[model samples]
Target: MKRKLLKFLNRMVLSIVIVVAAIALIVVLFVQFSPQFGGKASKEAIESYKNSKNYKDGVFKNTKDVKLDMSLKDMGKALMGFFKSQPNTKPEHDLPSTKIDSLNIANYKGDTRLVWFGHSTFLLQTQGKTILIDPMLSSVPAPHPTLGSKRFSQELPITIEQLPKIDAVLISHDHYDHLDYESIKALKDKVGHFYMPLGVGAHLLEWKVDKNKITELDWWEETTFNDFKFVCTPAQHFSGRGLSDRAKTLWSSWVIQSKNDNIFFSGDSGYADHFKTIGEKYGPFDFAMIECGQYNEMWPDIHMFPEETVQAGLDVNAKKVMPIHWGAFKLAMHTWTDPVERFIKASKKEKINVIVPKIGDLIYINSLEENEGYKFWFEGLD
Candidate 1:
């Protein structure tokens, strides 16, 4: 009887070992083969990054010290916080939005017009060019579909299949929310070009994007395509798509100048002097889209509060501003409508011209007089 029992115990141990090995193999394969994780910078790209002042010690550094987490213990706590149920983090109902008329967009030949698709995504039509800014239209903004929640709205302004051929796609960084793999895969063949901060081109190259279609720039770098000038400017932010690749790429804001309009996009940034610096250099913009959501005291050094959003708009010398980062995702613990609410109040106090438009509404950058009629669209949806 003792011999039989020993034999059975040995068989059980072997079975356990096999199961563990299988799980390990599955994990390794997923990490290695998944396209959503994005690509890392190649050795050649690393060599080029060495020339950048911001790239040091094998990572990109923010202009100021940023505390993403206090330590391993704090990171653990933050992880726990994310999993815990929080009230009012998301809207109780589907948010309001308008549908994009493809024919209207294709035929648009008037002044520069923009349609916000929420959470930093915009269709910028100007000078017969249709550019997409941070076009993250995926349902879940994570490395995998199961890793994140669905967007606030069940529908988008336009489906990928219906989107018109894009003149260019501008990416601020490689964060899953701002740069989505699914969206890019759908857009790669249709987009005329992809422009981004330095090192981000590595991911595009990994995704098999044609090298000729990609343009990467360092901070303060300027490139002109079809007479429209694109400038990559500094922002107080850190970037990484995975644990091992933290800060391997750069993050930044952008300045878009066309023949008749100047636009600024504050891609994710903390309240810092970079705003003032950018203002001094490219002050008095015709329009600016400032980030105004997804903030917490723990990571205060990276994201701006709504009050800071207004200040950022002012610092950039924007004649008019629209809050862009709050409408689509519940990335923070605050109520979904909190960002715009606070932002609107601050703007009124400062006497700043702010356009609070419904998502997908085509907004003329210089039509401040007409934008005054837009109502507080999110009033009852919370």
Candidate 2:
């Protein structure tokens, strides 16, 4: 009996060793090959960006030291706290079961029309031109198919193959969620131009996007395409897809100015004084689409809380604001609907105009009241 028990214990220990070894091998392989893994920034470009007195004198220098109040461990505890506090709450919405073409894409009549494609992606049509912002039409926001967040929308409003002739593509940064590899490869031959923040163009170039068609701009620098002026403005954010390359490239928000209207696209940012500076320089934005989700106290310096999003709108001097970066993925520990609900309440208190459109709904700010209040597409879930 003793001999038999010893043999069984040896087998059990060997099985455990084998399992551990397999897991370590998988992790190492993922780290080595994932696009989310490290890719070096151009040394020349990095030095130039870092040495720029304009950027040095700007808000980035001071905000780098702002420590987060929470950490990953704290986030895990917060998640438990949230679950305990809201025991009856279901975090995910029962996404509306609707066909892709059920909603019609409206033609903009002088005013801008925006179609939310989930997360930070949008289809913007104005002045007879169409622009795609961060065209991340993929099902996952990570390099591997099984590793990242999945879409909340039951179906994409329009598939990449069904897109109209895209005039230009604007990318805020090179994170996997925003600058997806599959989407870029698919749209490579279709888009007319690619506008990105400095050092981001390197990724596009690596992906075979035409160098001449790619325009990289620093903060406050402006470029013109098809009569529209795009200014790469500062945002309180960092960039990296891997552990090693954090802050190697710049992230930004954009101010798009046309002949008669202006729009601000807060690509992704944390709370900072740069918003006020942007408003002072480019005040009275007709409509602003700002990030309002995927926030946690752990990284509040790079992602704003819900109340801060409202303040960001006011800081940018926007006439009307739409909350974005939510309703798509569960990147943080908060309830899925927390960002929108908090934004709605805070906007009302702040007297800020907030437009909450459905996944495929097109919102025209000039005639927003004519359209009914934003229907809570996620209503029936919890």
Candidate number of the best lDDT: 1
lDDT of 1 by residue, 1-382 (tens): 9999999999999999999999989877887888877888878889999999999999999987887766777677667767888777888888889998778887888888998988999999999899999989998889887878779997888988888789999999999889998899889999999999988888888888999999999999999989899999999988888757889999999999988999999999999999989999987899999999999877888999999999999899989999988888877778888898899888888988899888888798776683482488888776
Q: What is candidate 2's lDDT per residue for 1-382, written digit by digit as tens?
A: 9999999999999999999999989888887785544355576766677654434532123245656346678867866754455432334544553334412433344567778877799888888888999888888888787876577765787888777568899999878878888898789888899998877877777777888888888888998987899999988777767655556567889998888689999988898899999999998898999999988766778888889999999999998898999877767767778898898888888888788887777677678762144566665665
> How many steric overlaps are in each model, in order?
0, 0
The candidate scoring highest on TM-score is 1
RMSD for each model, in Å, please? 2.7, 4.0
Cα-based TM-score, every candidate: 0.93, 0.85
lDDT of each: 0.88, 0.78
Could you tell me the TM-score of candidate 1? 0.93
Pairs with backbone N, CA or C atoms under 3 Å apart (clashes), candidate 2 = none
Question: Which 10 consecutive residues of model 2 have the lowest summed lDDT?
Answer: 53-62
Q: After superposition, how far is residue 167 of candidate 2 from its true place, in Å?
A: 1.0
